[model samples]
Target: MKPALLLLLLAFTAFQLALCDRNFPSIFTGEMSDFNIETISKANSIRREYAKKNNVANMNKLTMSFHLITIAQRLAPECEKVRPGSIYRYVLLKPDAAAAAHEENLKLYLDYTYARNRPLWNERVRSMEQDTAYHLEFLVAEQRQIGCTFANCTRTVRDEQTLEYTTINYGALCLLGPERLFQGDRPKWYAFDEKKGDPGSACLQGLVNDDGLCVLPPPQRGVTRIPKPTYIPPSTAPPGTAPTKLETDEINDFFLFNELRRNWARNNGVSNMWRVEPDYDLRLKAQKLAAEDCEKVWPTENYRYFMRHTDKTNKEVAAATHEIFKTKIDTILHEWDRKEFENAIFRLEELDRDTASVMEFLIAEQRDFGCASASCARTVLNPKTLEYQTIEYENLCLFGPSGKLMANPPYNYSRTLPPFNQKYGELASDCGPDGIKEPKEDGGVLCVRKIPRISIEPRKPVAQALVMIEPKMEMIQITAVSEHSLNWRLVAILVCLAIMN
Candidate 1:
């Protein structure tokens, strides 16, 4: 071969290799630097917004994961086919060796109609965040990594009657992350801490860079560092001084309830709904009642109450109930879509029969309430054989002012009246209209009441108030009649219900 021809042939081969590198880079050793800077910044900005809304100061900014990017690249070819609007394809992929400790979130979008006018990456991300069905993943505080890739593809579709085929151009966006949305039965997307310090103070190493993000400090030189355990020990402060696990759960529940209430009211076209406030007195009364029994109970006149029971411990039952309630909200709203009622009215009769009436509690004018939970084990005796069995119960109770659910037929409802406005000599139209808005740490506002403060007497301690045992004995009979047995046996049992003292 001639020398000049050989050099030209080698040059052509090198150009082809460069093209392959740009089109489909090797996935085995990619890094965060592979993603665009703007993409990283925009994604982090959205996360920051959610963190602020959730009152979390230490939310970590997102970093791009190359493993996720490689996955996205591999799935990009699927965009050539069109899918129905109601169907979204979700594929779970195993993490690579480098990403073994990470979970994953994979999302794909194909715009069949937007071949000519593809949206910019920033706009596309915003659209993804706005989509109600898929937005939760982006809002999750623990999911702090993202990777995305886009592709332009064409699909060929055949007309059913005309016997013609046409090529349609489309754009596809694939997003990958180190975490998936709704990985567990958590009711909310973010963790809410009411006492979190200033912005970025919660970051690892307590550092915030120029972009206003919580970030970890750079690794130090020459020393091997041991990884710390994920669990942090609770403060050793005396009880009632430092927040307990139960108290944290209550705070989260309070935040979730108010947030859900506000969203529901807005969706249902109610504008004058007021935020409920936590009352320590009410909470204590609730705790006392909850420790009494495992059975469901209704509140008396002038107050509203809701109770939930589970086989779990007192600490776990509230979360379990919240998870169950969250799943029922959509169906409840759908069934009541056509109903017409006053904005602030709550009917106890409707609540009494509806299993999903927990939602009604949200709209109920139950301002100033507290929640309490308790667990106990009871022993049952079989009188016939002198056999005993143990059963456990957990209960959660919320007690508050009932909006008036015991009146006459249709008018028998509780109403949340607006707070009186002294400046204008009239009731405030909304929580913020009369300059009585109480700002909360979670970026929410509450309506303030102007009545003179009255001292509330403290109730007896929970240990003393709890009902330990039933004074009366209840008899139960169990009949055993089987096809294989020639005779029938009857067993008599005595149940003495008791709660932990």
Candidate 2:
């Protein structure tokens, strides 16, 4: 985001106040809270690893937040009683044996009786002296455990040679055999019907060669005609406030006025698109958008919104979407050949961007499909022999997983992104592929067994590793600490956060 835009969004004033309110219902910023002092401490410890990656200024943001929070909590008397700069400079950058005599901390540490007063962080230090269990619990609390736990499971794993499988792990989720959810009956291979060339499509023809290089065909030139959505956008209102119904006679002679204005634009060609936003009433008959439709383009609603809101005549948005799709796909296609391509995968994966990877995977899968199906034989040019070899499959039907057909409602999703072209066909959750369907002729409604998903993740191009590590026995045990004990522990969390920065 541009700095101006970011500032406006963060500002208490401006239209951003409305934008900010939309997300206020769920605050996952992970800001400092009093929920758990230990949890905060663990988080602060992890935060330090990330903090070191940046400069001191970035680290100060974390400390400053703690400072602000503490300042806000203090009363006017407490503020007056506080020593200026004392908290910030408590830790000496360097130490000297002689200088230690001048510091008050030396006496507090040396004299146990005097230490009864409790030096600034005495109780907080004691809290850390307990067993490692406390730290483990704070890191991976029981409340967050899922998928697998140690109670019913042992270290035994499946022995492939003996064909014996272990079912101890994942007992909570996999009440049956462990492989029950892990195994699938669906055919693992599916590709574009090669004979039916995917013209102007982003799905390329290729494979990850034995050399570990992507040997894909160059993208074909020219754009195919883009398909409009099957669900015609209702004569609808854009975001913000919904549009109110306008009676036919709401504006006397409105239809005639609409027709006249449209005809004038038709006579003027490209020049008229700029004259004004095509009147929506007039647009009931207007086919395409002119330059003026850009104003009504509510971005986050997805490209479909643009498709519906645009005039079929407006070549600008359509051309833009096409170029965007091609540009993103081309970049991916090129990246596939690079050694550094693996680095493109982000830790916080993006389903939309990962679509490119899936498209390529589909292409690779199809390379085998032709040979796998008996009727169709695939001929491969062997890199080793430079001779073409024909490969064949015994009439097998390849089916990709259920996730390939995903229908996630997008937020601010761009339809022009690669793998989103209409040529790839509409992605529907309950339609073709792994989805169930009714039998033709309605001969006893068709039934397809639905597979239980083992994960919270859907079978999409972007998949996260669903993993949780069991904390040591100590962390799982929540021991109660006294209220006074909590005060300094909480203070330790605040101090650690500030000091870490």
Candidate 3:
């Protein structure tokens, strides 16, 4: 049967059943749970009815048969084929290997995708940061140009080159004229009145030239030469005024690393940085301070921590700090060791129970049955069985070797000469060619048939036993009746009753 058609019928039947059971008008009812049950039940009913009509069993068996038939029809002779042995091999061995190989393949694809995206994504983020900085600089420049200042300045030099005698000593205006002209302020330049032959044509207005030059319109001269504003490198800020370039760089580096750690935490929780050992406690504590004020401090602490652990200049202390940080972070992520801890805790308990069960099996009784010819054993196939006998204590064995481990290929059970084969005795009939039948001396009982066996070493030793007991009471009842003797007994009973009457 076509799988698609089969699936369709199943779905329809499930829909009908759900509609009937739930009293729903249709499978497409508004109630989601009802709709789901209706659909599922209908599909199952249809599949069940179809299977009944076709003598198919459960869905899994049906699916397997369906796949096998499809494969048989579709594949050329050279193509791989599935057989019973192949099925067994796949179940026993190949599936685990295949799953592992598939997992590795998936990881390879994922890694490839990750590697492909990383550089492009990183460059994009970097470009965005640069763009942000440019916009900030533009905003700051606009603020400075519009007379945004706080105080006054001084001018150390103020005399016109043309009017050499007129010296406008505007005290400090040249240096501290306005907050807008503070040391870090933007320098504004203008085209000189080159039409007037001013050699130093364009310059930052208000600055004092060597000969005390002045602005074109001469707003003020004091701000120009406030002692040349003492070449205060940005580094020369007052003791605690602000961060220096070196400090800023260190702080930024720390923030970048911290941000990387935070992102990894967001993406995979602690899992991503399981190997990274940063001082999360210190970072978090400092972070609690308002970022407007504490951002600098936090970054400083992180930089210090990074230096203590990662610096090669202090090898011994660096190694020790690294180990300390590793231990601290490992403790924080203790959940990662859940599997290891669980295995350690439960190891002995499981071993004890398994050993006890093996010992009980070793002490149990075993019996023998009958025998068969080598050819019959070689040619016939054994039915799967569930019978298990406790052979030796810890050295016990299953009736069938592999399957007996759970139960698979039927074991050789006909061993002893008895009134009936022990296996047949247990089953109440020797399975015959037609079905099941009584055991006979000619060894014609069909149940005793054996097939070729592949032997493997048992995990434990198998024990043989010699034992005898009365046949089970149920066996007596079943074995006592023969067709010929049953009729004779009826006849004799009738004659005796007639004579008495």
Q: Sort by TM-score, best first.
A: 1, 2, 3
Per-residue lDDT for 250-306 in model 3, tens only?
Answer: 222222222222222221112112111112233333234322232122112112211
lDDT to native, each model = 0.36, 0.22, 0.22
Q: Which predicted model would earn the best lDDT?
A: 1
Model 1 Cα lDDT, one tens digit per residue, 63-173: 554333444455567645422111111221121221111111111121221233345422434443323222233444444445455444444533322436655442323
Clash list (residue pairs), candidate 2:
137-475, 287-312, 288-311, 288-312, 288-313, 289-311, 300-412, 403-459
Q: How many backbone clashes does candidate 2 have?
A: 8
Summed backbone clashes in each candidate are: 2, 8, 38
Model 1 earns a TM-score of 0.32
- Off by more than 4 A, model 1: 1-165, 168-294, 299-323, 330-365, 371-395, 402-429, 432-435, 439-444, 455-501
Residue 384 lDDT (model 2):
44
Residue pairs clashing, model 1: 58-202, 403-414
Off by over 4 Å in 3: 1-243, 269-317, 331-501
Error of 1 at 223 (Å): 29
What is candidate 2's TM-score against the reference? 0.16
